[model samples]
Target: MKQLMDLANRDPLARRWAKNCAFDLMFGVGDDHYQVEVRGGQIEAMRERPSKLTSWDFAIAGPQSSWQAHWAPVPAPTFHDIIAMRTAGHITIEGELTGFFANILYVKRMLELPRIEGWLQ
Candidate 1:
């Protein structure tokens, strides 16, 4: 996850999307959640949780299969994008939406880090 942030930080688009982005966000797959805190355009911390997600800027939650597909080395069509997954009834979004919508590309890029880094499972 740190590597994901590091990669995103290097991208001009990502940096632009992250400008003034200071908030806590999280995503869930099945029973697990990863809460991430961002400050000054960089990741402050990320912690694993079991539904103890308190305040957050946004959240992306989906089934394990959906997450697996999203992280796949070569994802299938619908799983390749967050909105597509949501459209297909595979994922859900919650919390503040302005930031989420504004930095959507960057957020999607972050979620695709595992694939870009060849950390596919």
Candidate 2:
């Protein structure tokens, strides 16, 4: 997944997707979680955490199936978007959400990199 994050720095469109959206966030699958810190369109850190230490602007969690479907090259219906997943009860979002909701498009695009780069399939 770090590879997917790193790809953003190399993509003009991806970098732009994160413009003015600096913040820390995490993704949880099963019991393991990973934090991704972004600053100025660059990923400062993307590491797995045993447990939460500090807070995040937002966090997204779901079952491995949801995550896998999300990383599909072309997802189906509910898997196509985070909001869709949440609406369908396949994923959950938490924490300070104003920033996340405001930049949902950018955040969504950033999260889609795993599939965009063919790193998941």
Worst 10 residues of 1 by lDDT: 44-53
Residue 101 C-alpha lDDT in model 1: 86
TM-score for each of the candidates: 0.83, 0.88
TM-score for candidate 1: 0.83
When summed lDDT is taken over every stretch of 10 residues in candidate 2, the lowest stretch is: 47-56
55 Cα displacement, candidate 2 (Å): 1.5
Provide backbone clash counts, one per model: 0, 0
Candidate 1 segments exceeding 4 Å error: 1-13, 50-53
lDDT of 2 by residue, 1-121 (tens): 6676778667777777777778788878877788878787677888888355767888999998897898898989999888899999999998899878877767787777777877677
Error of 1 at 96 (Å): 1.8
Residue 87's lDDT within candidate 1 is 94
Q: lDDT of each model, Cα atoms only?
A: 0.79, 0.81
**Model 1: per-residue Cα lDDT over 1-121, one tens digit each:** 5576677678666677677777777878798888877788767678778356377889999888898888888889988898999898889988899878877866877777777767765
